[model samples]
Target: MVLLTLWLTWAAASADTTKFDVQPFKINLGSEIPRLHALVNNTRLPSKALYGVGQDKGIELDFLAELRREWLEVFDWEAQEAELNRFTQYTAEIEGLTVHFVHEKSADPDAIPLILLHGWPGSFQEFAPIIKPLTTPTENVSFTVVVPSLPGFVFSSPPPRANWTVDDTARIFNVLMTEVLGYKTYALHGTDWGSVVGYSMYGSFNTTVRAAHFVFLPFFGPTPEEIAADNITLSDVEKVAENKGNLFVSLGLAYRDEQTQKPNDIGLALYDNPVGQLAWIGSKMKLWSDPRAGTPPSVLNTTAILTSVSLYALTSSFLTSVWIYASNPNGFSTTYSQAPTDAPMLFSQFEYNIIFYPEEYVKQTTKNLVSYKVHDFGGHFPGLDNPPALIEDIREIAAVFVR
Candidate 1:
């Protein structure tokens, strides 16, 4: 009887080792880097714009040229890869798909488990700067950080079937934290499309997703008329944010529409073309980042931009990464419904996020609103635009809710 029980234990462990092997990962583009350089060298950009050239005209011709030169001559993918690999990373089969993630466990036994998600045009690299800070022991608190490459992005496998949604990804991640990593309850922070998936987990997996923090949400806040009717006055900063949002709707939605309507076209066109990928992805990275980047606290710079473009180009996942837009037409247009969770929720609003959710409208979506901080800088990508503030905000949330 004792032999039978021992055999059963060995068999279970063996199955787990074979089927759900979580192995260390290293970023090795190998020959892809040289090929990428060749592509950049051979590329022919449009003759510098003759007239009427500006931000409204789309990515500046001169800027694209600069990026092309940097890609061929200055950008070092190997160095960037080494920097990224400094964190503990691994790949495991989750939900029958290969999932790549950075799992940095804190030394503190009671540290909070926190998952950070990234969105389109961004990869797991979005949270790279904050991983060490979050996991290191601090006077306030620390986190056992889990940063995953969203399905169809970077190292992760693309969705195996059509119509895969953020909620599906959320379920896989929940299983990863609870069953795979053995964390019964975890906290999460998300931005851009990450917020969409994080919201799903916060609302649906409330039993395990104990607390949450977000820089963006999937739903639209109250319309201007609704705000006026409710007598909700907008602050000067908020008014500026509202104007920027209106600009985004009018001028910035072309990429969204193309990705939504013709995912295959853009995907295939830029599949093997590294320069094209740089222009397409770099434009957004440049435009959406804090305008004051390169200054203190905002780390968005040339190397960061090139590294992002390289990740998409070298992974060969550029084509599949845009699948999120096409898969869910209403992904970002979700009506403001109450997030069905009593877990404490916190938000950090950045000045240049393209949209603003007034505190009143934000409160309407959740029962437990613990914190809402407004920063004077930072754009859509807070981790890149304002890493210090972003790090501080996460620490604050963990101290209050996760500790």
Candidate 2:
């Protein structure tokens, strides 16, 4: 009886350990692409805006209509899928959920291990522009880039419980890096909701998450009184950035309320509706991006926009992805303790990101801030808006913080 029990215990242990094994994945949304085309073909766009085709009123009807034309007549999913597959992709079961990620290892024997995180309406694809450059830099520095889809975002499974928070997602990501991949330490860069998780990881897994770079933060910026108390100086450019930020807070966050209060409504409404998804996500792709995105050097083109929506629609993850807002009510208005903690932190402040947190305010959140970069260009999605600039900022951070 003792011998039989020992054999059964070993078998059970083997099965449990194998469950978290990473498996190769490719973005083959084959038949789903056809269904998407049909949905776009049949979608009826809303009537032109009363104010005409302009962003001041919502997504311009003319712009969205052109996008619709492009989606049905010009966009190519297989081409985009091929581009995404150029790098290695994989999925692993972690904490009872299947996690999808892009893992690109550098040839450099001493390459730094790094994980890139994405936020709402964005996926692992957001880091596509920087993945190859980071993993295979011309200079001596290189990284093993690991970009994971946030829970319920693209190919990753949704949060198993409605009460799930970014803190929970942070815990699983730590497992991805330290436990599954067997990395003693790693670094991270995040934007949008990714920054929220990145902050959590930096605080909770400091021994393993050695450093972080963020383009956005979950904390509110300093108020006028706080700025006066600090006697901080602001440049003319900083003044303009602050004004734009005010415009965003005053006029731009109604979507936040809807998503946080009634995620199910918008999620279900746009879940299978390709055009609806396009209009919803495509508008933000343009609005939140730099005004100069269509010019040379910018990667925020119509095809990129379409590919983002395709990832959400093809995977049928729109509903689950929006649950993030409802799951964490205090996401944006977090009150950090004055006491700074965690590994050295780095920041990249883009000119057009909706909110502007001055270096003074950012420093309050962490004790060991190593760098803060201010860019004249780029917006919320800096990886797409300005890849070279973002890459440089990250590399500089790694040189200082990563061993």
Candidate 3:
């Protein structure tokens, strides 16, 4: 019986060890440009429009119309594709699916291996600004950055099966880092859905995932009793964040709910309609970001938002991407586990994020909670909203692993 158990364990580990091919990839959007242009130009807006307070009533027609014009005229897919190609991009077959990623190695011999995970409505482009900086040797630390597109988003192929969850992504990414890339152990940093995937990896592969940093936690949030027990004190900013979080849960989660319950319905509706895709994704980009950071107030750059939308529209991945919610219907609702993780964990609390959890709340969910930080600026998309601050925070997190 003991021998059989040992044999099964060895076989499972060996299955994970199956080495796969990694091939260089480049982004090409030339053929899709004409179709994208037609879609943008043909989009019609309501002649009589009513505006509400800050995305409460959905994306304003004027804002989306302006974005549509820019998508047709100003945004250059060729230039963006060229920029993307500057970094080393590759795709590897893992579990019969193609996983696309950006692998930027540092010149510093002692640089740490770091895997960055991005969430929905986001691709590896989130880390574009920080990648070079992270790879450059700083006085404190440097990292060989590996940013992977989530399965079914952007360049990566769609999920092979219908029920692909973040947990499955976690396992495949672990294989990419350890078995494919030859990293014995690596550190992880993630935001939004990326946090869920990174958390799974941290829990499931503790020996290989040395430490982790997250801007989002799992479903286990602090209850009122736990909050009272901790005797937690909140600053005025934190109080506002809490209110915003409450508002988001009450009013702002319709998109999440739709995706979780009936992804295919909206997915099929928006699959070929770039205008629909824009309204669906662009609203979140505008509402979830820091208003002061970009042009057009609270929204991201027109080109950036268009680029993101174009990726989905061009690739026909809107359906597959939304399916993540379906696969993990209880992800945001169910507590993954109460048992603390052995890996060192760090978290960042951004004021404008959709969900806000106090440090006390985070502590209850983590075992070796090394550091908890509160940022005055930045929101859900920190990589775009506040890259410098996010980069610095990641550096601080990386220091824990190096030491």
Clashing pairs in 2: none
**Best model per TM-score:** 1
CA lDDT of 61 in candidate 1? 87
- Show pairs that collide, candidate 3: 291-298
Q: Between candidates 2 and 3, which one is better according to lDDT? A: 2
Best of the two (1, 3) by lDDT: 1
TM-scores of all predicted structures = 0.93, 0.92, 0.91
Tens-digit per-residue lDDT, 1-403, candidate 3: 8678556434432323236777888888789899888877887877747644456778988888888878877888999888878999889999988999998988765577899999988988877878999999898588888999999998888888988888899999998888877777789998888988998898888888988988887664554455568788888777766766777777888899899989989999999999999999999888887666573222347777888888899989999999989998877753435424577888888778878889866776677889888887778888877787788888886657842
| Clashing pairs counted in every model | 0, 0, 1
- The alpha-carbon lDDT assigned to residue 22 of candidate 2 equals 80
User: Model 1: per-residue lDDT, tens digit, 66-98?
Assistant: 988887888888899999989888888987889
lDDT of 2 by residue, 267-301 (tens): 99988898888888888888888889856557988
Error of 1 at 33 (Å): 1.1
Candidates ranked by TM-score: 1, 2, 3
RMSD to native for every prediction? 4.5, 6.2, 6.3
Candidate 1, poorest ten consecutive residues by summed lDDT: 9-18
Query: How much lDDT does each candidate structure score?
Result: 0.84, 0.83, 0.81
